[model samples]
Target: METLGEGDGPIDIHDYRHGLKLLKETRETSLWTNKKGYACPACGKPFEQLFTSEKQHNTFSPSSVTPFCIRREADRVLMFRH
Candidate 1:
């Protein structure tokens, strides 16, 4: 199966978190160290931290939601919602 951030497909939460862990291991912060107008999918509240959730939410109701973090430093993109 194609892994998250590998193929031209959407990302999974578990895979997203795992990627974060790997990034953390190499550095103290993320490579996409900037926000590119990221916001909440449900409420539209702007935020920076692209986090994962295992609880009830609007975007992925029920449970187990794997969101993305699309940010922009100068001219890039990141992701997240919660």
Candidate 2:
């Protein structure tokens, strides 16, 4: 994935969005994560969506919950990274 930071170059919000779009497109069908509607090849099970918050606290803004998906198995809860 393209790292957006000062060392590489000036990163714009549009650039970030474009990168995300590309990533999503490239791995839309691949079973990279266990999201809802995603069939896991390792284990035959479906996933349930979940939400967690990322710390983005600033002087003018607060953090918000980011929706994600996970599959709870007997041994672990497979968290989706997409």
Estimate, for each residue in 1-82, the C-alpha lDDT of model 2 and write its tens digit.
1222323233233433432232221211212322224332233334332112232321212232333344333333333332
Residue-by-residue lDDT tens digits, candidate 1, 1-82: 2223443444343444432332222222232211344334433554434533222322434442445444333322334533
Q: Estimate each model's TM-score.
A: 0.25, 0.22
| Best lDDT among the predictions, by candidate number | 1
Best by TM-score: 1
TM-score, prediction 1: 0.25
Question: The CA-based lDDT of model 1 is what?
Answer: 0.36
lDDT of candidates 1 onward, in order: 0.36, 0.29
What TM-score does candidate 2 reach?
Answer: 0.22
- Least lDDT summed over 10 consecutive residues: which range in candidate 2? 22-31
